[model samples]
Target: MSLRDMNCTFSPAALDAPDVASLLAELDGWAISGARLERRFALRDYHETIAFVNALAWMTHQQDHHPDLLVTYNSCTVSYCTHSAGGSLTNNDFICAAKADALYAQRAGA
Candidate 1:
């Protein structure tokens, strides 16, 4: 399913690794780290890093699906999973990953 088709109220069935693998392929710079979908964004500097993080925060807030963010001087690592699914990966994770990719791409293109 497309990321736009996903909602915050995802069923807790937890997509299997194979299914998650397919979804991950469509998300740029994202990887499956055990049961979590993870990605690291390397920005030009701390300012860019924070801008990316704030953009991501706004997106997550709108979606009501937040990821764990690890911020540094010039990078941020985002990790996502469904706590409702016993900490398993779900479509919501991939959905947010896709949105995050688009946000980063747009920033880069600008």
Candidate 2:
């Protein structure tokens, strides 16, 4: 599935291992760990890190999907999994992962 041009909501459905593998290929900086999609990003500073988190919060809200975020002084680790899908990988996870990547790119360009 191509997620680059996607703009949609997260409808939860469990993905099989093969399907998850195919989708993960198209997502940069993201990997499947256990049942979740995970990505780690290093930002410029504490301020930038928080800014990134805030931006991500807004984006996830708009998509109606959320990820587990771990924030440090200059780093963020985002983990996505759908509880509705019995804690498995879903399109929502990849969709939000793609959106998070876009937000990071925009921040980097600025």
Look at candidate 1 and tell me the lDDT of residue 57. Answer: 100
Clashing pairs in 2: none
**TM-score (all chains, Cα) for each model:** 0.89, 0.91
Q: What is the lDDT of residue 26 in candidate 2?
A: 83
lDDT of 1 by residue, 1-103 (tens): 6785576664657888789878877877888787789999989999889999999999999988899999999999999998888999988888888888888
Tell me the lDDT of candidate 2: 0.85
**Candidate 2 Cα deviation (angstroms), residue 108:** 5.1
Error of 2 at 3 (Å): 1.4
- Residue 45 of model 2 has an lDDT of 94
Q: Could you list the CA RMSD of all candidates, in the order they appear?
A: 1.8, 1.7
Model 1: pairs clashing at backbone N, Cα or C within 3 Å = none
lDDT of 2 at 33: 80
Clashes of 1: 0
Give the residue spans of candidate 1 off by over 4 A: 4-6, 10-12, 108-110
